[model samples]
Target: MMTKHELRREYLDRRRALTDIEVQESSLQIANKVLELDIWSFSNYHVFLPIQKQKEINTQYLLHILQGKDKNIVVSKSNFEDISMSHYLLTDQTKLRINSHGIPEPDQNGIPIDEKNIDVVFVPLVIADRFGNRVGYGKGFYDRFLKKCRPDVIKIGLSMFEPLESKIDMHVNDVGLNYILYGEEVIDLG
Candidate 1:
């Protein structure tokens, strides 16, 4: 099993190899693909955008404008400059954060939902397999969060590179992505 430190190193190295243009192009493509889905035709979908990194569309801008006109959107609480692999829900008023791990008591202000209400979710990952298994930042935040989400919730993995051959040590609780979007292509895991 690769140690957390080693995995971190490898992930960072691969992620850093991506150029600024590559990242932007990948993100734009992923955003475009998301907009094409018919699911957004009638229902209100909550989009969590990352804060901009070096003028790139970070979560904030992504959530703010990606849905285009006449769409419902919400932004999560800014814990830091970047949001990690966690899940948040949108309410009629605003977006609320949830504790993926039950260990830390969730904030009372967290928006409550029956998971089934969520239609789609976009998850970030350091690396992903062709099978859609993802490796996160060793926090298991997305894994735990997926457990509580509806099985039908479209889980899309966002990354800077194409699928790698490396095997990710996944626990039984680890969640698989339905699709993965990279700079040049989108792989449907379905």
Candidate 2:
């Protein structure tokens, strides 16, 4: 099995090789697959926005579907100072601005949502394994953030690529995903 560092570079390279059109089409497919899941039953959800450069899954269409269902859609911004993320309610009027890392972060003025109230979180990842182990950019932000959520909160990962056949390097502090959606499938690891 490749180490987390090696897998990050390899997966990132593969993601970057995709053309803009391919990214759009694949993202649409992944989004459609997500809609097939029973995740909509949850009234409150936390979604991570796409970082175009990182080739993250485009969640705009998914966000619209969630909004149409009257679900409380929430977004998060990195608190660089604390190295932890804070969740905020995303609304029709929520203004978004790109952060230094090129991620579209919600405005700080958004109403905060307590961690316990979130039913599910659509996670971001650089790579994930069949065992649900995930490797992000090594910031440990999501690891810290997920720890605060309720024990049964469903943690889902949105990946443009499928899970690695082998397990990823998992540490005690790393938080594994319960489900990972990639291409046209949602692999439930829970």
Candidate 3:
């Protein structure tokens, strides 16, 4: 099995190889597949916006769906120093700006929302296994964030590619996912 570092590189390279149109189409397909999930009943939903430079799955399509459903959307601002993220309630009045790391996030003026209120999280990952273990940028951002949430919270990983067939070596602090949403596919680990 490949190490998380290697998996990150491989998946990131695959993402970088995607053309702009391919990215758009795949992201839309994944977003459409999300509708098939039974998770819409949840109220407060946390989502990660794409880091364009990293070729992450564009979450705009998913955001539109959340808006249509009138879900209380929550976004995060990262603190690199501690590899932690601060949650904020995303609203029409919330101002967003790209951080130095290329992540689009809300400004400090955004109203804070605690992790306990989140019922679902649309996780960002490079790849995941059918067992729901995911590999991200190795920063432990999502792992730490998910750990702060209620144990029953649904964690869904969004990817442009399908999950890896091999099991990933999970760290002690790693948080597993409940579902993985890829292009026109969903792996329900629950």
TM-score of each: 0.67, 0.96, 0.98
> Which ranges of candidate 1 are over 4 A from the true structure?
1-5, 17-22, 36-38, 41-48, 51-66, 74-114
- Please report, in order, the local distance difference test score of every candidate based on alpha carbons: 0.58, 0.88, 0.92
Going through the candidates in the order shown, the clash numbers are 7, 0, 0
lDDT of 1 by residue, 82-115 (tens): 4333333444554343433312222446564444
Model 3: residue 57 alpha-carbon error in angstroms: 0.8
TM-score of 1: 0.67
TM-score leader: 3
Give lDDT tens digits, candidate 2, residues 124-179.
89888888989899889999989999999999888888788887878899988899
Pairs in clash, predicted candidate 3: none
lDDT of 3 by residue, 1-190 (tens): 7899999999899989999899899899999999999988889999999999888888999999999999999999999999999999999999999999999989999999999999999999998888899989988999999999999999999988888888999999999999999886798999
